[model samples]
Target: MNGVQLLLVIVGAIAVSGLAQRRGLQPALVITLVGFAVSFIPGLTRIELDTEIVLGIVLPPLLYSAALNFSFVSFARNFRPIVGLGVGLVVATALLVGVFAAWVVPALTLGTAFILGAIVAPPDAVTAVAIGRKLGLPKRVMSILTGESLVNDAAALTLFSITLAGVVGTHTLFANPVLLFLYSAIVGVAVGLLLAVVATVIRRLLKDSGLETVLGLVVPFAAYLLAEQIEASGVLAVVAAGFAIGSSSSRAGYQTRLQERQVWSSLDVLLEAFVFAYMGLQLRFVMEDLTAAGDSVWEIFGVGLLVLLVVLLIRPVWVFVSFGRHFLLDRVMRRRIASDTRVQERIRVENEQRIARGRRPRQFPVFLNWRESLVVSWTGMRGVVTLAAAAGIPLALADGTPFPGRAEIQAIAFIVAVGTLLVQGLTLPALIRSLHLSDPRQEEFDREQAEHALEVAQAASAGVYQRFLASPPEGVPPELLERMTQMVKRQSADAARDPDPDATSAYGEAFGTLYREVLQAQRNAVVDERDANRLDDDAAREFLEQLDYQEAAIVSRLGYRL
Candidate 1:
C-alpha cells in the first residue's frame, strides 16, 4: 500500500474503534483484530512502509502523551513496587525466556533468542490504561499498572538494543552491558529533566493558554529527539519528562490544567487506536512466515506457551514468597517479641481496626493481598514495542541467507501479545469479582476527600468575599459578592452530596437553572459594556473567553452535557 492507503486505513480504524469503545469493547483489541482480518485480503499483502515511521514518528508522541497524564505522586509513593515490576521484571522475564528459547528452538543462537525475549518483555501503557479504565479498577491498581508500563518500555528497549548489538557481533558481554545501560538511563533522565525545566520556564514567561498548549505538544518531541541523538532511549526521556511536568503542573497555573486536559485527552484517543491498528496490519507478514515454516509451527507454539507460562507463574510465586517472608512470618516474629508490652496491645487493636477496614496491618512491610497480585499479573500485555522490535529483526543471516528463525520469532511474539492482551485483559474483571475485590471503601474515601477539598475552596471564596465587602477592587460591581456567594454555596452542596444518581441528579437540576441565569447575566453585561464603549474589542473578547471557561466548569460540576 502507498501512503494514501495507509492513511485511509488508519483513519477508518480509528473511527470504528471509537464506536466500539462506546459500546463497551476495547478499542485496541477491536482495531487490532480488524486490521489483522483486513490484511488477509490478497491485494493487501503487498503494503510496504518505513518501519522508522512507525517506531520513531509514531511512538514518541504516544509515549509522551501517556506520560503527561500519569500521576507522579502515586508513582513516587509506589516507587519500589513499580521498579520491581518495571525494571526487575523485564530483566527476569528476558533472562528466563532467553535461556528457554535457546534450548527449545533447535537452530536459534542464544543471542538471537535473547533478542526475541527482550522484544516481548515490556507491557503496553495504552492497552493497560484503556482496559483498566474500562474495568473500573481502583486508582491504586491503575496507578501501579500505568507506572510499570511506562518505565518498563525503557527497560525493554535498552535490553533489545544490547541484544541486537550482540546478534550482529558488534558488541560482546565483556563490553560491559551494565555500564552502557546506566549511561543510557542517566542521559535519558538528564535530557528529559533539562527539557522539562526549559519548557516550564518558557510557559511561565508566555502565560498565553494557546502558546502554552502548543509548547506542551512540542516538549515531548524535543525530549525524544535529543535523547535519541545522544544514543539514549527516547522512551525513557519521554516518561521522565511526563513525570516532571505532571508533578509541576499545579504550580504552573489554571490554564496549564485546562490546556493539558484538552491536549492529552485528544492525543490519547488517537494514538491508542492507531498503535493497535498498526499491530494488526502487520499480522499478514507474521502469517506468511508461519505458512512457509508450517512444520516448525508446533515448535513455535510450544515456545510461546512456555514463555507465557513462565511470565504468568513467576509473578505470583515471587510475590507470595517475598510477601510471606517480609510481611506474614516477619510480622509474627516481631509481635512475639512485643507480646508482654503495652505497645503490643495497642498494635493488636490497630491491627483489628485495619482488618475491619480491609487494610493490611501496619506491621507488614510488604503488601500481601491477592488483589494486588492479580493486578500485577493481569497487566502483562505487550504491544507496540514488541511488534516494532520483532519487525526490526534482520531479514538475512551471516551467510546472506534469510534469517533462520525470523518467522518463528514473529509468530511467538504475536501469540504472547494477543494472548496477554485479549485473554488476560478480558478475564481481569471476572478475576477481580471472583477474588471478592471491591473498592467501595476507596470510593467513600475519595468522596470524603472531595468534600474536604471543596470546603477549603469555599472558605477561600468566603474570605475573598469578605475582603471585597470591606474594600472592593476598583470597578468591581456591587452584585459580585452575591453572585460569588451563590456560586460557593452551590459548590459546597454539590461536594457534600454522595456521588450517586439521586443526589447528583437533584443538585444537578438546581445548579443548571442557577448556572443558566448567571451565564445570561454575564452575556448581557458584556453586550451593555460593548454598546456603551466601556469595553474595547479586545477587552470584550477576553471577557467572553473567561465566561466560556466558567460556563464549562459549571457544566462539568453538574455532570451535564458540554
Candidate 2:
C-alpha cells in the first residue's frame, strides 16, 4: 500500500477503535469488523498482509507491552503452568490439528497441515488478558494469561521453523530438532539480556526522557530482528528483553517510565487496529482462492469447524492433564521442588520483600480450579500472530511447485483466526460471568497493596530528603523544604489508596486541580519569553514540552500497581 492508503487504514482503524471504546467492546473486534465492511466500498485500495511487517515489526511491541506490565514475580511463580500451556500446549495443538486436518481435508499434505496448525496455535491472550483486567479475574489467572501470551510465540515459531524446514529442503535443523530448539532458546535469551543491558546504559547516559523513551520504543523490535539474524528465536528475544527491562524499570527515572508507558500504550492500540483491520480485509482474498478449490460450502465449514474445535478443546484437556492432575497427585505424594534456595526466594514477592528490608515468611497457594481451566480454554482465540505465521509460509518449495496446499492452508488459517476471535472472544466475558467466581478478600488485598505502595514511596523519598540535607539548594529556605516534604508525604498517602493508576486513569485529579494555576503560569511564562525573544524557538519548545510533561504527570500515580 502507498502512504495515503496506509494512513487511511491507520486513521480509519483508530476511528473505529474509538467507537469500540465507547461501546465497551474490544477494539480489535471492532477494527476487524470495520475493515470487513469497508472492503466492499467502491474503489477502495487493497492492502495485503506482509508477514515481515506483522512478525518482525508488529509482534515485538505488543509482546513487550504485555511483558512490561506483567508481574515478573507472578510469572516466575507460575512458570510451570505458563510453560506447560505456552510451549507444551502449542505443540500438542499443532500435532492434533495437523492430524485432524490431514484426515479431514484429504487434499492437504501432512507438512502443509502441520504448518497450518502451527500458524493457528499461539492463542492471542492479549484479548483475554485485557478482558480479564476489566473483569477483575484472579491475579493468578491473569498472570497465567499474560505469561502465556509472552512466551507462546517462541514455541509456535520454533515449531513453524521446524515444520517449514521439512516443507522446504532444509534438513540441517531437522537432523536434531531438539538441538535447534535449545540453540534458539539459549541464544535468544542471551541476546535479549545483552541488548537490555546496552539499552539501560544508553538510557542512563542519554538522561533525556524523550530520547530514552524513543529508544525504549525501538528496543523490542531491535531485540527480535537482531536475534533472528543470528538464528535465534525472535519471539523469545523480545520477551527476555521485556522481562529484564521491566524488572529494573523501577530504577529508571519516573519521567522516562511514565513517557515509555504512554508511548507503548498508544503504539499497541495502533498496531492491533491495523493488524485486525487488514486481517478482516483479507477474508475476501482468502475465500476467493478457496472457491477455486471446488470444495462444497459444507465441506469447507466442516474443515474449519474441526480446526476450531481442536484448537479450543486441546487447551482445556491439556490444562487438566498437565496442571490439574498434578495438583491432585501432589496431595498424595507431598512433593517439594528440588531448588530449595529459589523456593526460599519466592517466599514473599521480591518487591514487597525489598520494602520489608529482607525476605519475610509468606505462604502462597498455587491451585487450579475447573472454572479457571474452562476460562483458559475458552480464551484460545487465534490472532494476527497466527495469521502472520501462516502468511509467512513460503509460496514455493526448493523445487518450486507452489508449496503444497498453500491456498487451502491460508484459507484454513484465516477462517480459524476470524472464527475463534468471533466465537470465543465475544463469548468469553459471558463465560466468566457464568463461572461465578467468588469475590475474593478484595478489601484485605487492597489494604496490603496500599501498605506496600506507602512503604516503597516513603523509602524512595527518604533518600531524596537525605540528599537535600547533605547539600541544601541555594536560596531554598529550610521551612519551605520542610513544608514541601510534608506535602509530598500527604500526596503519597493519598496515592497509596489508589488501586491501579495509569496515565489515562487519573488518580490525582485533586492534585491536578491544585497545580493547574502553576502549570498555566509556566506555560504563560514560556510563551512570553518566546514573544519577547528572550528564548529562542527551540528553547521555548523545549520548555513547553517539559511543562506539558509535568502537567500530564499530575494525573498519574507513579509506582502504584496492585
Winner by lDDT:
2
How high is each candidate's TM-score?
0.77, 0.80
Task: Name model 2 segments beyond 4 Å from true.
Answer: 41-46, 170-174, 293-298, 333-357, 362-365, 398-400, 459-484, 494-562
Off by over 4 Å in 1: 125-136, 168-174, 253-256, 290-295, 329-368, 392-404, 460-471, 476-562
lDDT of 2 by residue, 222-256 (tens): 99999888777788888889988876664566577
**Model 1's lDDT to the true fold?**
0.68
Best by TM-score: 2
Model 2 per-residue lDDT at 275: 81
